[model samples]
Target: MKIAVCGKGGVGKTFFAGSLAGEFVLAGHPVIAIDADSSPNLALTLGLSAEQAKAIVPVAENEELVRLKTGTNYSGVFRLSFTVDDIISRYAVPTPSGASLLVMGTVKAMGSGCACPAHSVVRALMRHLVVERDEVVILDMEAGIEHLGRGTAEHVEILLVVTDANLKSLETAANICRLAQESGIRTIGLVSNRIADDRQEAAVRLFAEQHNLNVIAQLPFDPLVADAGMTGEPLDRSASSAIKAIGELAKKLRGLA
Candidate 1:
C-alpha cells in the first residue's frame, strides 16, 4: 500500500502517519516510512533514538550526495536517471517497530529557474520508491504535497487528508482533496483526529458525509498519545484509541487497493 498522509499543521497528521506505518509493519509488511515534513519528528514517533534520527541525513541537505547523483559540474544538464536501490540499505535507519525510515527533509526552491539538485534527487528517489519498488510506502507529507507532483501522484494508491473538528482544518482537507483529485489521485479519504467526544465525532462525520468523502477513521483525543510524544517514545498500541482506529483504517485502505 502506497499512501500519503497530509493535513494542516498541528492536526496530528504525523502521529497518524506514524501509526499507519506501525500498523503496516505489524501486518508483516516491510514498510518504508518517508518523513517528508520540513521539520521532521517521525523518528521519535517511530521509536528511534534522537541520535539515530539525526544520523539519517536528509537527502535535500546532502550536497555531496546530490552532487554525485546529479552531476554538479554542469549547469543545464544533470543525471536524472540513477539507481537509488542502494540508498535504502545505505541511508534508511530501522525503527524498533520494524519499519525502515528515510528522512526526505524539506525540498525548497532556491529561486526561479534554479536547477535544484536536491529536489531532483528527491523526485528521482521518490519515483524509484513509489513506482519501481514493491514495499509498502507511507509518506508523511507537509500541509501541501508540493513535492509529489502530478506525475508522482498518479502512481500513489491513496492520499489520506487528516483533520479535526475545526472547520478550517476540514476546509484545508477539502482543498487538499481537490488538489489530489486533480492530480489523478482518486482514492482520497478523510481521517478525523482528536475528537474529544461523541458530539465532535458526529460533527466530523457529518461534515465528511456532506463532502462525499470517505471517513477512513475518527481518532479520539487520547492524552497517552501526547504523553508518548513528550517522552519521545513510540505510541503504545494496546488500548490506544488512536492506534486501534488507525489499524481499522489500515484494513480499509488495504481493501481499497
Candidate 2:
C-alpha cells in the first residue's frame, strides 16, 4: 500500500500525509512516511522533536557525486556512498506507534540541473527507497509533483491531490493532475481540505464531478489542527473530524474497512 499525497501549497498535504501514516500505524501496519515535500514539516506535524528529525540525514546531502567521462552511462557514473539500510537508519525515526519517517530535503535554491548533485542524489535515492523498501510507503510531496521527474511517482499506488474551496486551489489541483498524467502517474484522486459546511461540501463534490476526479474525503476546517501545530503536538486522532475522515480514506485505499 504505497501512497503519495500532493497539493497546492497551504492546502494541508503534509498534515494529511502524517495523519494518514499515523492512522495506519494505529491500525497495526508498519509504515514508512516519506517527507518528500521540500518545505519539510512532516516531522513537526507528527510531533517529533527537532533533534530526532535532524538526526535523519537528507538523501541528497548524503549522496556522492562522481564525474563520469563524456560517454559513460549516467546511472553507472554516479555513485551512492550509503547503503539503503544505512540511508534508512540515518533518516528514519520511529514513532512510539511504530511508523518511521524519512525526510527528503529541499534542493538548495539552485535550479534543477545535473550540476546540483544534492538534488540528483536525493532523486536517485528516492526512486530506490520507494521501489525497494518493504514497508507501506507514504510520500508527502510538494504542490507541483516535482518528484515525478525523479521517478518518485513510479512506485505510488495512489496519488491524492488535496485542495481547498477556493478557485486558485482548485486550479492548482487540476494542474497537479495534469502534471501527474504527464509523468505517468496513475490512480489520482482529490481530497478537499478545510471544508466549511454543507454548502462547501456540495461545491467540492460538484467541482470533483465536473473535473472527473474522485473526492475521497472532505476535511472540515478545524481549529484544533492549527492549535496542534502551534503547540507542537500531534493531532488527536480520536477528536479530530479531519483526521478521522483521512483515516477512513486510508482504510478505503487499503480496502480494509
Going through the candidates in order, what is the number of backbone clashes in each?
A: 0, 0
| Model 2 misplaced regions, further than 4 Å | 54-57, 62-85, 107-111, 150-152
Worst 10 residues of 1 by lDDT: 107-116
TM-score, candidate number 1? 0.92
Clashing residue pairs, backbone N/CA/C < 3 A, model 2: none
Give the per-residue lDDT digits (tens) of candidate 1, residues 120-177. 7887788788887899999998887667864677898899999999999988998888
Candidate 1: give the clashing pairs. none
lDDT of 1 at 251: 87
What's each prediction's TM-score?
0.92, 0.84
